[model samples]
Target: MMTQGTLVDATIIEAPSSTKNKEQQRDPEMHQTKKGNQWHFGMKAHIGVDAKSGLTHSLVTTAANEHDLNQLGNLLHGEEQFVSADAGYQGAPQREELAEVDVDWLIAERPAR
Candidate 1:
């Protein structure tokens, strides 16, 4: 059964950066983004899973440069009692679009290096 708590995260779906296609250009829909010290080129797959059942409940795709937090609202089902996400989603609660959302934000803190 679906639960009221949702876990949200994103992964990069990498694509070749070479412009070898018929148009001799990289896919317009894909974009480049940096992670840590490496640069990734492609799209991002944002997913929301039911915390209890561990089943995916929502999904959104966007250019790799898009911030994970930008898709937070779309990943939610609007019935969540709480939302859990990684440090990438920091400041999500402060976003104007999500300011009125009445749910606990269990965003993780980045570990000290």
Candidate 2:
């Protein structure tokens, strides 16, 4: 339901972060790629999930190095409640994109690590 004067939107964005694999391995997940001895790939699949019902609405996948704000507009459309993301999404443009759509782009605050 659309609010009296509020806007709704939705989108899929990729949050790319590289994490070192703690486990030892010989063969990589894919043989076509190689990096010295142990092949590694960093990837983060950003998905749009329903905030109210806690359901995934859509998804966007990209390389681990891809920027989260790079694909913000891809998911903008009518009927979006809001956007929720991890600290990796704490960027400037992301909030602006959602603002253009008149939607609340909520970012999960990360504790100082």
Candidate 3:
């Protein structure tokens, strides 16, 4: 059973840009995206975790270029009293697809540099 709070996050799974298969072509499912000062090519793994237990409850994957916010709706289980995420998900509550979701959002703010 899942808890009342859910934590969501995404990570970039780096892949080599060089193609090794017989086709000699890069993976069609992976794409390049810039993070900080580096460029990464691969897929992004979006995960939803049970806050109380720290166990994963959901997962979604997309091309590296996909925005983390795009997968927020799919990571919810509909039973959460609150949802927590990093600064990448800052506007989750205002996203049209999630407008009707009543959970309290605990999105983090980007730290000042």
Candidate 4:
């Protein structure tokens, strides 16, 4: 069976920071990022899912502050006919990377005020 498309996105997972001890104070692999007025500390999981069947096809974990587009290349399976991503994955650099491949890129349009 031929794979239809790949849906790409990322989500942050918060790390617990309840202890005062140096080693327990924070997770070494996790980091912080500010979105709007809130600051979050944790890691981000970048994922790609099959658009037609809703099955996960790829996953990559990175520090919280890592940008979403940085993991785009790793999420592609080379079998997808197209790729769909969010606004966070838009821009020239990302487009250039996609240009190297033969799949169609479907990036969401960012709302303008």
RMSD of each: 1.2, 9.6, 1.1, 2.3
Estimate TM-scores for all models: 0.93, 0.50, 0.94, 0.85
* Candidate 4 global lDDT: 0.83
Off by over 4 Å in 2: 1-42, 92-99
In the range 30-112, model 1's lDDT, one tens digit per residue, is 99999999999999999999998999999999999999999999999988899999999999999999999999999999999
TM-score winner: 3
The global C-alpha lDDT for each of the candidates, from Candidate 1 onward, is 0.93, 0.47, 0.93, 0.83
Local accuracy of candidate 2 as per-residue lDDT tens digits, 30-69: 1221323743354435555455664554566555445656
In angstroms, the error of model 4 at 111 is 1.1
Against the correct fold, how does model 3 do in TM-score? 0.94
Instruction: Give me candidate 4's TM-score against the actual structure.
Output: 0.85
The 10 consecutive residues of candidate 4 with the worst lDDT sum are 17-26
Ranking the candidates on lDDT from highest down gives: 1, 3, 4, 2
Over 4 Å off, model 4: 18-25, 92-97
